[model samples]
Target: MKTSLQTTAFAFATSAVLAAPALADEWRLNNFLPETRPESAQIEKFAEDVNTALAEKDFSIEVYHGGSLGLPNTDLLRVVPTGAVEMSLMWANYLGRDAPALGSVFVQGAISTVDELTDVLPVAQEIYEEEYSEWDVTTVGFVAIPTLSVSVFCRDEPVNTLEDLRNVKLRVWAREQVETFERLGVAAQIIPQEETYVALRTGVVDCALYPALYAKTISLQEVTGYASFLYPMASAPYALGVSDALWESTDPEIRDAITQAADDLWDRTNQYDADIENEMAARESLAEEGIVWSEDFPESDRALFVEAVSETWKMLAEEAGGNALDYRERMLTALGR
Candidate 1:
């Protein structure tokens, strides 16, 4: 009886979601990040453009910030396809556990510089389209998350090199990271971003990988005393995924507006690299708060880390069981590896 009731509830939720778009003459875009984020502003602008373009048609695009629809970021793979949300910002890296083929295509942690990041994106975008197309989710545009430097923070030990991480338990965000570190013979765990400081304070994790620009946002300085710039951390931009269901029903004029907005989304951000100045500013701020900066990763170690992470990427692709291996090869060739 309980199982049947749960199934009924899910069915009702699905129906309600499917019905929301056309009947209301409004297409909802679900962005899980808060409105205050720099990227959210662009998304809002995208919606406004779409709504304005469709003004004559009695249709509108509504922007819901901070996951107001109560959707988990990870569930977007299925949600967007099913029209649970007409559109959404899906962080490909965050969805790795579910779509290894797309998610692990390029682990930003594996990349060391902005040029390398640039090289990988075209390949990653292809895989995203190929795999997402398999489920009928269209990749409209992307918001480029700048190449914020990755800082390895620890409470007691300073992680300046690969060898330095050996004695400490690292807290990484994804299983691929956990496995990559594990392959290096270090004990690593997956800790949610919100609980990282607590985990560090309570001795649950000895180190964590965080962007240097936002370390203070999570109060990493309060618990961890030392940090090192480990990599450039050019994370895959948030993908603007639109459902085919909604797209097919929309007029071409409205589609052109969305396409133009998305194309301009990338161009708008290309005006400046948001992280370069901010990361240095953050480092100085963290230093004032008593956080000691350590030597950045040596080229030798960066190369080593890239290799370890690459192995995990291959393993993920092979296990994902589709055109994953083929996609992985294209990614490697793009990287010139």
Candidate 2:
């Protein structure tokens, strides 16, 4: 009996020793984008950087990209809460069904540039945190792709003016995009980004609207001939949200390390966009690679487009059940509008 008691105590001590190592060394993170694209490349880099930083502190992390661990793009909010997965970089707009306020952000055409968003991200972050926390999610930091400036990349007909928007079959990614483009008379069809090139090549779509980064990343410039500089009407940002339960379980030091690295990436991304000289250089490079950019549409024409969508603010406010109106007032008050 004495020998058996000693063996039992030894086994218990061994189990405790094993559990301590598990607590120190293992982690899993998910990124939903394909590695072929530039923005996705940046996300991969961020993950690698985090892993490297943690390793320097005698820890390690495993990163699953392209939704390798699971279809995080569609199921993370569900999976994360149940501990099916640990961490993720979530795009707010895609989670619209769960978080309507996210989609509401795209309602107005006023926030045209990254510079404008920089001032407003704090308020947006606060709003998202409040909403996401209900689902047991936490936002680590936001990663923005340099202006998702939508371009009408057409196969046969290039859209140069507002009149060209009429009856044009285009691919749209968001409901707000559909509504706003429909108001401009576009025959919009919703489709995923992966299918856009095939849709354009097969004549299923006459034109498609997406970011310059996407165009450059996927060689969409080869299928389309011209781009319209519709600045405000076509700009957006992507965000990254983490699983709150996972965050709470993480060692506070590891959590701080990841958050700090993500914050650095945000600053890097913002710097990349804020450097007008670099953006101009990128534009020139893309132009050299067969992308045609038109300078024909002047400020007055741009103003006309904004004027045409003048009721967006009111419509959005109504859609947001007065909260959007509150947001709008906040933005306007910030700008002294």
Candidate 3:
């Protein structure tokens, strides 16, 4: 009787051990964009989707927004590879100082529309993956936050021609924008986006070059009176990267689940960009705020702007070295420029 009782106890212990779940591998994802932005909302959805897809696996992701994680937006390239952060949504142009080749995606006239961007995305992903691998990071996905166009919003006067932009202090971001504006004979001021409203209101800068939706979000329309539709600057693409160590250690199934979630988000981004509701909301906001909108630039002016930006691209490619130039050429070819 004693032997039988001991055997039953041992079998129960074994069953309990076998039924226990494995420890979960938790990952942290960082996005520097404000939580209210559509991009940040999409990142949150991605985390939820990934969790759902990997429900059976011991994998999870926790998201941090608005720089809460203490990682500077510009340092993602350095930090992501060291496993200091498990994942990040990094802007391509932020790396221009060190790797100008990565900024080729934001070449002003390279890709103009969502359709064009969608067509070139596969090639872009391939190029980006190869470039980022040098930092021991793997590209899981890419997103191009939609804008009506890269526009020029002026405080008092309208910017309708290249001549109109002459000597005008316009807020700019990224090295490409500075060079492009320089060629166009505009004074480019590198102002933080958060500070742009006060800059415009106080006349620190005469105009700003940014997306219309963003301008509305920040109440920039309160100070700006007119907007000019410039040639479609390719949306500066954002990449979602995973640390190489985490990626390699993760189960293949978990990796696929995470990748699928990202790919689905990528596929849906185009629709989101084209959503009429979002477009109408932006229009309503601008109208309510009483910001005047200018018609598109004349073809002649548009052509000249494109020409000036094209020259800047050539100069940037040269300055960035042989590989950078080669990457630009490949992107141009892929983009059918």
Candidate 4:
């Protein structure tokens, strides 16, 4: 009788062990920036929050920084679709191959400020789903990485007006920028940010069109002599996307926990970036390191700059399957534009 009772208890124990599920899978996140960059900092915070939430819910994640997963800029769209990586933080412009329609959201003079961006995302989301579905990625969150002011950063000469931008060799991204600048008689080169400084130093490119944050983070200010405040480039915000295959395959409870964690992260990280802007002293500290913030330039120049790029906007809108006008109308309706 004793032997029979022991055998029954062992059978029950083995059954329970077999029925219990395995630990949840850990996710991999990839970004192009160095681990020290502010964008990486924001991502790290998000990962931490998500990991914590996951721990409570019996799931986890592992972040891979600095493109360690071998996702070069060129293969971004293809890589995401093939599930080579689980998630990535990249500029939407990079996905132009798979989804040119996303560019409609960031055309010059199209989106002026962060408030306008937040209001326009609902419409953008609809468009992203249609476009990104082809690429097999889902837009999880759209966070503005502070408002970026575009300018010609040069080591040799100062570009103080719209005419000064003409005939200069500038490094730029996005097809529209290339087309627009070329039309204005400026020679445009499409180069990655990693190579921009060297390009400036070597004179391969005479100048670059990028953000002030580049000055703060990478010391581009020290490398350049002039920063022409042209159209405020606030709309080219960073977006975080997840591989649809991975997301769809994830356990439902784990997916819910991760989505909630992402929501929490967006609030925390964007608030931090915004709070830094609110504190004048903090912004000044960054400015002291060669950042020149001025709207004091001639208002006349703004019109010329806009006129030069206006046709490019129309071209992009037409290319994006009429999304350019649709997005503009949606934003104006939201902002009473």
Residue range 153-272, candidate 3, lDDT tens digits: 899888877788885888986777788777777789778676788999999999998877666656777888888777665465688998787789888988898899888878766453
Q: Cα deviation of 50 in candidate 1 (Å)?
A: 2.8
* Over 4 Å off, model 1: 1-23, 55-58, 201-203, 270-275, 298-300
Cα lDDT of model 1 by residue, 64-176, tens digit: 88766767676676567666677788887777655667745766566667787788877777778777776677888888777778879989978888887888888888778
Candidate 2: 10-residue stretch with minimal lDDT: 13-22
Off by over 4 Å in 4: 1-24, 56-58, 269-297, 320-337
lDDT of 4 by residue, 1-337 (tens): 3234334434443443224422446667777776767668778877777777677665666667766655665456655554455677767676665556666666666565667666665666566565666566776765545655665676687766556667577888667788777776777878877777788888898888876555545557667766655666555556677768777887787777667766766676553245335434433554676655444237786665577666776677677775556864554576565
- Candidate 2 regions with alpha-carbon error over 4 angstroms: 1-26, 56-58, 66-76, 232-237, 272-275, 295-301, 308-310, 322-329
Model 2 lDDT tens row, 144-189? 6555454566667557676776757888776666666666676788
Give the Å shift of residue 7 in candidate 2. 43
Better of 1 and 2 by TM-score: 1
Residue 296, model 3: lDDT of: 71
Which is superior by lDDT, 3 or 4? Answer: 3
Question: What C-alpha lDDT does candidate 4 achieve relative to the native structure?
Answer: 0.64
Cα error of candidate 4 at position 258, Å: 1.1
Clashing residue pairs for model 2: none
**Decoy 1 TM-score against native:** 0.84
Residue 130's lDDT within candidate 3 is: 89
